[model samples]
Target: MRRVLGLLVVVFVAIVCAGRDLYEVLGISRDASSPEIKKAFRKLSLKLHPDKNPGDDEAAKKFAEVASAYEVLSDTEKRKKYDMYGEDGLKEGGGGGHDPFDIFSQFFGGGRQQRQQEPSRGNDVVVPLRVSLADLYNGKNIPVSMRRKVVCQHCHGKGAAHADDIQTCHECGGHGVKIETRRVGPGFIQQFQTTCNKCGGKGKIITSTCPVCGGHKTNFGDVEFDVDVEKGMQDGQEVEFEHYADEFADRSAGHVRFRITTTPHELFSRDGDDLWMDMNISLKEALVGFKKNFVHMDGRIVEVNRNEITEPSQVITLKDEGMPKYQYASEKGKNYFTSRLLILCIGQLNIKINVQFPDTLSAEQKQGFRELFAM
Candidate 1:
């Protein structure tokens, strides 16, 4: 829990700030190069962009700051003005350059007619997770190993040796979309549009492909994830592991879904969230008082006692002894459980009435039986 809390704190600090300087916002020195500034802006803009963090006003504002920094630092004339007169100088040097999204889109692919970019997610991988009913009732964590596609570490999914090594498409001239004119009749032509074939519609090609992933920008690898089996988990229910599926270059990772499967128990049977078991009592024990110890799922021993006469196939229910409720509360203050127990009691005394009387009983035994019946 502390680890999760710490991660959230890190994310908060990374997204929000208290008026840090332009260089500090980009986390670069004042002497950083143009290429270095470009790299920094690309990374931060992708993370804090309004496109990625839609509806998050804080992140959107932060992205604007980042883009402003890159807008000044990336231009030679504006960088000189900023270095001399700071942000005020940049405003005097030129109108705020361009919109942050436009800058981002231009850096990725330079075109004014921009298509709406939807974050891409890979195909979801669903697998079965098997567990005992006791595990489900008590709740537990199980480690699961998966084989999936991850971004190439060597090139960081760029699929190139260097950012400068990427070349603009020869056919589309980096617009990604191409226009074609077809001759229909005399002096009449039809205009159509299509994607650039040379760069596969990306508007750029890597001069050097990554050695590890062979320009696919992804690598096949095995990863382990902890699957939490929450209390009162139902069979065939799905537990999702977000952003853990296949990853691609400049694309969002899909989710991994785990379907819960509860295994059958030999001694106990399950009915929804409740447990059921059978118990037998002797004739004397059923007639008088009796107590017995029952070993439970976690090896804890529980006492089962009865003083009244039991009937065959009779059910005894115990409340609050079942599975814990998943985010379900019984009252305002008390957290309740969804599961319980149903015990089937079989009485031995019921069988004696149908049996024939024993002829070999001794005089003492006969007298004892007579005394017992008299009582």
Candidate 2:
């Protein structure tokens, strides 16, 4: 019976692809490699899919043609025959009776023999991580401890004590859904399908559940790892650990992301790559000029000097003295090692001057100032 159906399909495909060259349909050379053929098919199928090109008849037809071409060309034996003798050779039992959407699903999400559906993904876990502003200036490694669900080791995530103890659901015929027809009116009938309660949509029943996980297929466990806080990483930047979230039976684990939060510094504030700070100066120093040692975030000393009178509300700009410029690993290239030199990669530091005036002037000081200024 299946052979008859296969023959009918072959005949239909031969009719549709009668004079069309399979290689031309896929826009690839006759000697294209297997990976090339697959790549071409994936690209064309995505663009010409029926869902993407809704209400477009020409695209739908081309989509079918592309799928047909890939179906025949992807198979080693069928491809050999089609290459040698053309589409007619496939009708002689070269094995080209597969569905096109099945191929798409196999590449996109589900493996062969499964319905076309998006791959299941678990939810991501985001945690807040606080660090000092100095940590962002100088890269730091922060150790983090997390509690996540891991697959049961004893049952290997099967949810059953033994493989033989698992059986297909009898209620839905292992499809996990039941269809029923009901009378809607005197002469009308309605049909609808619902998830089978017996199997909870799992399509399998475990007679002997795993003692450790109790058929849940996972257990909570503690895990620890170091989160690298790269230099100049912006606030709220996430450090991601892939596939480290809670585990499920058949779904892929999501990422564990740590959102970096930099703590406020007492002496410095940042804007993009620049650092702003307030510098307090005494009235005498502002008038006569003075040199002061300014401590940087990494304990480096920066000399703040003025040879002339320093006015209040003055701004002093220091080049390449702020935060380190953040560079991605890929962007580092050959200059990564040299970037540690502040002159090579850094930002500006702006210091705003605030001069404190003396509350009371002595009579001798006022007289001296009056005589010096010839008032």
lDDT of 2 at 19: 88
lDDT of 1 by residue, 308-360 (tens): 76554566665555555443222122323111211211111111112123448
User: Per-residue alpha-carbon lDDT of model 2 for 1-375, expressed as tens digits?
Assistant: 324433444455555788899999999999976656776886698777655665675676676678889988877888998888877787875455455555555554423224234378788899999988999999888988899999999898998999899999999999999998999999999999999999998788889989999988899998775777878988987776656789887887877889989999999999988999999999889999989887899999999988889899999899988899775322212222221232336899999999999898899999988998895
The numbered model that scores best in TM-score is: 2
Against the unseen true structure, what C-alpha lDDT does each candidate score? 0.66, 0.78
Q: Which candidate has the top score in lDDT?
A: 2
TM-score computed on alpha carbons, candidate 2:
0.63
Q: What TM-score goes with each of the models?
A: 0.56, 0.63
Off by over 4 Å in 2: 1-118, 183-191, 329-344
Clash counts for the predictions, in order:
3, 0
